[model samples]
Target: MIEKHTSNNGLRIVLENIPAVRSVTIGIWILTGSRNETNLNNGISHFLEHMFFKGTNTRSPQDIAEEFDSIGGQVNAFTSKEYTCLFAKVLDTHKEYALEILADMFFHSSFDELEMEREKKVIYEEIKMYEDTPDDIVHDLLAQASYGGHPLGYPILGTEEHLKGFNADTLRNYMKEQYIPENVVISVAGNTDDSFIGKIENYFGSYNAEYKPSNIVRPTFLANTIERNKDTEQAHLCLGYDGLPVGHENTYSLIIMNNVLGGSMSSRLFQEVREKQGLAYSVFSYHSSFLDNGLLTIYAGTGKDQLPLLRDTIDKTVETLIKSGLTDKELTNSKEQLKGNLMLSLESTNSRMSRNGRNEMLLNRHRTLDEMISEIDAVSHDSIQKVIEKLFNQSSSTALIAPDTSG
Candidate 1:
């Protein structure tokens, strides 16, 4: 059973007790990320995520690491476009100690000036690393082309100039505004007892309860194309279209459509573009659903001479899917594929913790495995057709990074 509790101070707690398991995964989710950022502070959320592990008032960075390692546990965190998460996995017996350490970092991080400056250089190198990898940078470029001036378009890793400008106060101000109790969710999955609930409440109950209204303007889709000439051997391409937001009714149908289109090894794009015609080495499609909006993207990497053919092939694939739609056999196979993957992923305690945390943070509700499977099963061929028509038939933006031929 999944249990939920909301403290008076507005920290939402969710727990799924798996009595058979000897371990637990706990996640602290903050509902703010790049979308909440201004152009001047585009990557503050991600930067803060990094700083949280640097040290705290009572614990040095080494102490934090040593404690987790001593217990044979793991601690990590990540920042996404919509939220940031700090999480740990430990034996069920060690959960209390793990939570204490996490709470210490959460409530008492001491973003030392020296560490801040050093991390800035580290992040700058991270940004340059992405710049050198065209396959990775092409998606960021496509996002910029698709969303234009919107905050969603900004890379999660802010520019080098922006990183250089960020100081301790800049990060603290952003955290002060965004990281309040009401904007946080704590999720735990695996072996747990009733006492665990009270413990979590006691740990988080004193936080300030505050909610700030976000005035993020919805991004408009711009079907523009951008090309960057780099000194690389292969051309990397990304094609993006507008997609539905989280919890949209048609999202399941769109997922099914995506699978049949280009989501897997047996997908049309992979089979046709790579296996049959030998036009490209890699080709796939993905859908990203956010709070208020989403993006459907297709990516392919191939030699410069094959770029035009690859683009045309992908375009034709979309045109064909929009025109012909998926057959019943195709829909059935895709649904089973999605269901198998979903069930397999849930076998991990960490995956369950992440699912519970993200659902509560993003949707404020929990969806049972049965509920999700039913939704997937209920998707009809016509529903998928409609999704393909609605999303893929629309205008799309393209981004290409190719070797610079000009002298």
Candidate 2:
């Protein structure tokens, strides 16, 4: 059973207790990211994530990393367009220490100017790294193509122009606007105590400051193609279409639909395009959904010569899905695979903690494994067809990054 509680300050807490687990994983989820940012303050969420690890008021940077390591705990954090999370996995005996470090980092961050300036350079290097990599560049292009100029579609890593001007004030003020009690969820899984939750509540209860504003202008469906010429061995391609939001009931149907399309090694896209035709090497499909919008994307990498054949194969597969749809057996098997993956991953405390926190942040509620199993099992072919029709039955925006044409 998954237990849930709403604190007086409007913080949501979800707990999952499983016996036979020797470790505990906990996460602090702040429900703000690039999607909530404007052109002026974009990437500040990701920036702040880096700064928190630089040092906190109570701990040095090395202290933070070493303390966790000394206790054999795993700690890390990441930011996305919709959320930022800090997670830790530690032996059950060290649960309180992990929670203490997490609370300290959350509320007492110094955001020191020296560290701030250094981390900016680090992030700048990271930006360079991503820009130099063709595969990374392609996904960003796909987002821009699918959502146009909306904040939802903007690159999570703010542009070079935006990052250059981003300073400590830019980050602190953005944090002030976005990191509020009303927009936070904390989760812990494994052998943990109810009283430990109270300690968390006590620490976070005093955080009364109203956080950053969220004037998100949702992205609209855009139809366009963007091609970036690059010098690379393999051409990277990404095509995206409109999809359903996370909270929609059709979400499960779309999950099933995506799986039947290109989700597995045995998937039609893989079998026909890679195994039989001997195309380049990689092919996959995925769905990215938010509270108000979604995107369905298919990605492939092949030589420029194989582009036409690859495109035709993808188009034919989609057209076939639209016509005949998926079978009962395929749908059943896909759901079982998905369910199995979820269950299998739960064997790790870190996975459970991250999964619980993210789901609560996304859905604003706690759901048992049984609830998810039922939801996936209840998905039907007709329902999936309707979802597919709504999501991918039209023209989509494409982003292609291919090698220099002279080759």
Candidate 3:
């Protein structure tokens, strides 16, 4: 059973009770991330996520870690392009303790000056680590090529210069503006009881309810290619096209179309490019949907000499799908594949907590498991073809990292 409640200050709480499970996963979802940042504070969302674990007024960082370890619980957090989440999974008996610790971190983080300085160095090293990985950095380049000047294009990990500028005041000011009761969702799933809501209310009910409307300019897609010559062995590439935002009617159809095109190991790109031609080792397609826009991207890593062949194969595969569409067998197989994956993934308490939290955060509503299955099942051949035609006809932007032969 699933239940939802809203506190007087506007904090939304969602709970899923699975009597069969022995553990519960609780998540505090905040509606702010890299997209809410400016050039001056590009990576503050992620930086702040790291600082949340450093300490609170009542506990030191070591105390926080040791407590979770003693309880045999798992605690972590991640910052994305649109939001941040701090979450934990623990035995059902430890629910109150888990929530109390999270509440303390959320309400009382001190952001010590020395800790902030030390964390900046850690993040700087993280940035350097990502820069050294061409396959990883290519995706960031693709975002820049696709969105250009939009905040969506900025790296989630800000530049070293920007990181150095963030002190206690900078973090506090940003948090004051972004972290309010109205901008959060608390989700708990698994072997939970009716008392969970009251516990969440007690911890988070007193926050100020403030809404700050964002004035970010929506990004326009630019069809251009960017390339960097490196001394690496494999040439990494990402091809991106404009896609639909979340909750659009055509999003489901697009998912089906993507699956048949390049999403699965049995997908056309994987079969034709890697299995048949042996052109590339890693090949797949994925779509990212944000509040106002989306991106459909295909990625491949291959030998520099095989780049042209790989590109031609991908282009041909897309053209074939557009012209001929999917066969009945292909459509049925893809739908079942998607449905099975969805059902199997929800068996975990963590997945259920994430799904409930993200749905409430992004769509402001909950979709039952049956409703999602119905949506995927209702996708028709005509709908898939239409989405394919619309998506494939658009101009695409490409980002490439190739080995430099000039040396």
Give the best candidate by lDDT. Answer: 3
* Ranking of candidates on lDDT, top first: 3, 1, 2
Across residues 44-74, which tens digit of lDDT does each residue of candidate 3 receive?
A: 9999999999999889999999999999999
lDDT of 2 by residue, 239-313 (tens): 898998877988888888888898888788888889989885889888888978888888999998888899999
Q: Which residue pairs in candidate 2 have backbone atoms (N, alpha carbon, C) closer than 3 angstroms, thus clashing? A: 176-212, 177-211, 177-212, 178-212
Compared with the true structure, all predictions reach lDDT values of 0.90, 0.85, 0.91
Q: Each candidate's root-mean-square deviation in Å?
A: 1.2, 1.6, 1.2
Q: What's the TM-score of each model vs. the native?
A: 0.98, 0.96, 0.98
Backbone Cα, N, C clashes tallied per candidate: 0, 4, 0
The sequence of per-residue lDDT tens digits that candidate 1 reaches over residues 165-231 is 8888898888889998988999999999767989998889777845788777878888989899998
Q: How much is the lDDT of residue 354 in candidate 3?
A: 97
